[model samples]
Target: MKTHDLTSLLEAMFHQSKEMILFVDRHGEIVYMNAEAEKTLDLSDYDRNQFINICGHCMGMAASGDPDCTTCFLMSKEKLTFQVYMRTRYGKRVTYIANFQQIDPENNISVFTLNPLSELMKQQEFEHQKLLTQRIIQAQENERKRISRDLHDGVTQELLNVLLEMRLFKYTKDREELDEKIEDSEEMLSHLLDYIRNISVELRPASLDDLGVEAALKTHFKWLQKQYGILVDFNTNLNKKRYRPEIETVIYRIIQEAAFNAVKYSGSDEIMVNLKEAGSYNGIEIHFEIEDEGAGFLMGAEPKGSGLGLFGMHERISSVDGELNIDSEPGRGTKVEGYIPVGERIV
Candidate 1:
């Protein structure tokens, strides 16, 4: 092919390419940009002759928030490729993989190319959701296995023992022996009833269905005090107000998990739980908060447990269009708050 034809073909390809391409001068001004570059970077409004520093669009290049022009690829003598975030004209931050090449060394001209990272980010988000689903399934299965073991090893075995004792009653011919066997059987039956009740409470307290969330929480806190010696200061202004079953369940579970985490890891003697109504006029929102003045873990650090508890809480809350916020710091305390919009209430 002739040299002129080759140059024309390359120019057409450059303008038609999806990636944003810019020709920058030595003074960091954008000398020229292709069609795709103008649209992607939202620079169509700016005149090409008017100098615009490229660093104004950068989201910093070092530890600080200020853009570091010294480390910019355009200033480097060698070619460079790296990831960077840029603020678009609409004020949205976008990630891009950029390549900078010194096209003309004598004239100090460089060509910069940028490929957006939106698709890569979407793929990552999808993979994260898949992992979350797997974790939820595993948690459910583990809980079922635990319940099964408890029933078989504890409740079922106890019942079998009671049955064996009753079989001995047939061999007892004396009235006194018969009376003694009957009393033993009665005591065993009573114990078995208590065990079953405990398991029922563990699964889902009957009070939660019969009364309301407040009553159920009181019962749970009382039980916690007796079992783990952790006192819970419970407060709620809802005054037995009822909500959709799904909302109630999500709030209950989130509080349950948060309180359990505090008791298990916080090492604090007391925790606080508060539930109230938030927002005004257009909508009503239910806000529940659990706070512990105990030893809290560092934010973003690996949790001591399976890390599924918080994840499950988030999943459950979000399912009901609720928001969950957790605040904690080492040697300080932890607070978990959730808000659910329950719509306008009837007067």
Candidate 2:
């Protein structure tokens, strides 16, 4: 672009851009402001010829602390881009992303531009959710791989062995040999059946839909003890209560993941799980917790294992308008707890 055209374009943008643009001196005296700035800010407090107190309109530039004017933006010579809170015509303190740059060194005149913080946050949230959705899809695919491996390595191999044994039964030298082979194959097949059943439960148990969250969890805790020797002390006052299918699934899955994490990482032999109505008068939500007095970790430290399990638990709970909170400290017990609102409660 030619210099003359570039100047015209810049002039048009100064008059057209919706951002609150202002020119101020090093002493924070407002020199010039765009039409947009005049429309948004409450300037009635300051007279036209008076050295303006920009502080009245700007609450403060956000800093590491409480936006304290410790390091005033106007006092600095370097250009800066930061978040700032500014009062508007309606006396509302709205956050704005601000840019301050010295345009005239001799005069100490700087151009300040302000854009609403909400627009940036909305864009960032969209990107974050997009990444999260992709990760969840990957987690589901990994789960499928796990189930497939278990069936192939444990159940399918055992079944194939049984088939080979049956084929050789006709060639058995005597009745005693055939009888012994038959017994051995029967035991092998029985174990394979149990293994398959375990995988099926891990995928999505029918009991969760047929019975409810409480019953499903009881069976799960029992299985955990049987399979991993990790005892789960389960207690519940739900008393055969029922809920919407989706809500029940979310509750069951969140508890399941938490208990599994405790078993895998807690190093403690026992875990306690509590399930009950949360509110005293209304009982409008259900609260469940999985806790273990084990070797807990720092609250913000890196996870011992892949953090996908914890992330998935949060996603599951959030889908049902629930809240999940985790509290743990080194040498202190870890507790994974949450509440699921029960608007779809069924008797």
TM-score of each: 0.77, 0.85
RMSD of each: 4.8, 3.0
TM accuracy, model 2: 0.85
Predicted structure with the largest TM-score when compared to the true one? 2
Q: lDDT per prediction? A: 0.83, 0.86
Give the count of colliding residue pairs in each prediction. Answer: 0, 0
- Candidate 1 stretches with Cα past 4 Å from truth are 1-68, 78-81, 85-93, 101-112, 277-279, 283-285, 344-347
Candidate 1 overall Cα lDDT vs. reference?
Answer: 0.83
User: In model 2, where do residues sit more than 4 Å from their true spots?
Assistant: 1-3, 42-53, 170-174, 283-285, 319-322, 341-347
